[model samples]
Target: MKDFELDGWDDEEASTDAATSLTRTAARVEEERQALTEQALAERITAAVNAARPGVDKIPDPVDPAGTGNLTADEQERLDACVAGIELLSTATWVAGKSLDTVATGRLFRKLVHKLEPERCYTTIEEWAEIEHGISRSRCSQLRDGWQIGEVLNARGYKAPEGQVRELVPFFNRHGLKAAVGVYEMVVQAIGADKVTAKRLRETVKLFPGDLALSDEDDVNVIAQSLAGAIEGATPPAPKPSTALPTELKREVDRRSVALADRLDRGRIPRNEVLTHLLAAFADERDSRVFDVVFERMKTSNS
Candidate 1:
């Protein structure tokens, strides 16, 4: 009887060990399967991103030693002529980034970035933006989108007025291109494009139930200007000599600079023009009673 009991205990122990071993083996198999699945998914994503961009690999770098930006002789000549034309248009526009001229420049700039990729001159969009615009990659992205949207809007018989193109990007992208264009034309007709303000459009979009959401907050001044057509009619002041301001005044200028940029159309405005306007306003108003009280406080602080 003792021998039989010992045999039963040993069999039970062997069965338990076998079960544990099988569990570990199954876990290992599952892990291997998961790793392979992830690898395949990553490859698919990379291929899709590459496939979405056509002609990326085909364009040669402008600096390629093969000449004409790495093109054959005839191709080189063609690209050269194209490049020259782009430059001429850009120059003629006086570097007006938000204007129609920018559409051509942005298109050519995108093509150039792709062409230069083979040479590894600019490995990423950020690097390209830095070298091309001397601005942040994010800002470059804004300009590129604005340019493309402006071009499309033009084709659809809608002129992208001032900063409206940039403001309407997410709107256009959220809705299909055709639908967005139609919507823009409808909105323009309803409010009159010339009377349309970035702020008004933003508020209008908020009322939209589906397919369009509010993309950004509208600036108060931009809203007022758009409604009044003030910015459209306001001529840029003549260039003036630079003036150094006190530290406190400089801070105020800096604060206002940001506000002014936000307040204008296209989400960007020239710093010089902004400064000129600010300085002129201050100069003209320095003798006003409102400034006298502010100046008295400054004098007291100094004392």
Candidate 2:
């Protein structure tokens, strides 16, 4: 009787434990179902926000969907700003200080207006390229000739020399810029590529010999100042643009002054090429005669 009574108690205990386990499992399943339902609702909310926002590409998918990340008011502003036109233009990283020439300004304004119109929401890379190429012609040629010019241009991205922001200029125009290539390469060439090799340019620009692929800004600035001195004939050993060609070739400049003087010595730099780089880096035929006379005098003095 005692053994049978013990078996009966054991059976009851086992039945109670099993019942408790089943109840817990059911509770867990219901909890999971509710969680999933909440997740679906949150996703719907996110989708609605993204749909209403005009130009944004992504919605923040918080890791804990239910845990509203307790974003501060400022953070919420940023998030909400992502839904408006002000946000779209504010977030645009480039074009801050880029110059807008007569033609370029029109294109930019038109695009900006179109973008702000709410219904129009996209820009093709091709159209951007066309604008880039239209105003920036030598950018293409610099890529072809001077290895450094393109490097500097790309490194600077849309940033210009003033460090405010880079402006757009057409290639081959030579409006007022001091270079044949885009402005960035002009700086690198004006200084030393080693001193001015901006990492930003390196990534986008094609690398070249003495390309200044890894230099700091301060060093480049000093070197550029020195180069300006040399070019102006103020503080150089001399303007040996061949050695100076980094400064010259860096910008893919015509280097007519260097070439003209060089051809005068070797008779290789045709008058046309001289006129091309330095119409003033050279002189007229009368000046040429005086140069010849001075050359003979120097020879006689040395003899």
Candidate 3:
């Protein structure tokens, strides 16, 4: 009986050891599977990130086509450095126009011009630019003006295209940077930044005029808000085949016509003062004709 019990006990112990070994093998397999999954996930993420990145076109070396090999070593080195500097300035100019970093580009232009002294190779900065880049001095001046305007706007956490900002330089000079910035903010708030084109800004400046008390911040805000309200509430004028009466003038004419009809019903003609004001309001020749046509029809019908 003792020998039989010993054999049974050995068999049970062997069964337990086999089960434990199987569990260890299963755990190892699961761990390997998890590691493979994580590695695949990482690779997919890397590929997605790379795919989303913007592609940069390689800039060709500007000095490559110059045939500088025939020149002396020192001359070639100087030319290479000058060309590189000019290339940097050109790149910065483009980036500044796009990114609204005009101030930095303007400063870099002056610094590069002084450092490279294009006069050594060409007669003037303008000459070098015209010959190599086809950029005019007037354009350069406009960029510089854009930079000045950018300085004011950037300080207030605002941005505009170089062309749009250039339109405001005169306003800045007349009303000061603070007033200009106020106007810019107001216009942007009213029409949106994208709609603040050079033409639009120029019109706003003309409408507001330089003689107004734009220096006062409160007054500026009030004017800006008034303009903003007008912009927001005004209806887009319908397309007209011929030169149509201005919308505001049309509204005025309608209101006055009703009032004039009431006065005539009471057997009274419009006062001389009233007629004078009406004539004054119809400033445009085409608008005056429209007014004349409407009143003539009114007279013919009433008589």
**Top model number, lDDT:** 3
lDDT of 3 by residue, 114-206 (tens): 324555445354554555566677765565445545655665555565666767778777767666666788888878876777788887766
At residue 159, give the lDDT of candidate 1: 43
| Model 2: per-residue Cα lDDT over 222-297, one tens digit each | 5444334434543323344552335545344445455656767764454456445444423556457655666798
TM-score of each: 0.31, 0.23, 0.35
Give each model's whole-structure lDDT: 0.57, 0.44, 0.62
102-127 in candidate 1: lDDT tens per residue?
54455434446443356544445556
**Consecutive 10-residue window with the lowest summed lDDT within model 1:** 211-220
Ranking by TM-score: 3, 1, 2
lDDT at 189 for candidate 1? Answer: 63
Clashing pairs in 3: none
Best by TM-score: 3
Superior by TM-score: candidate 2 or candidate 3:
3
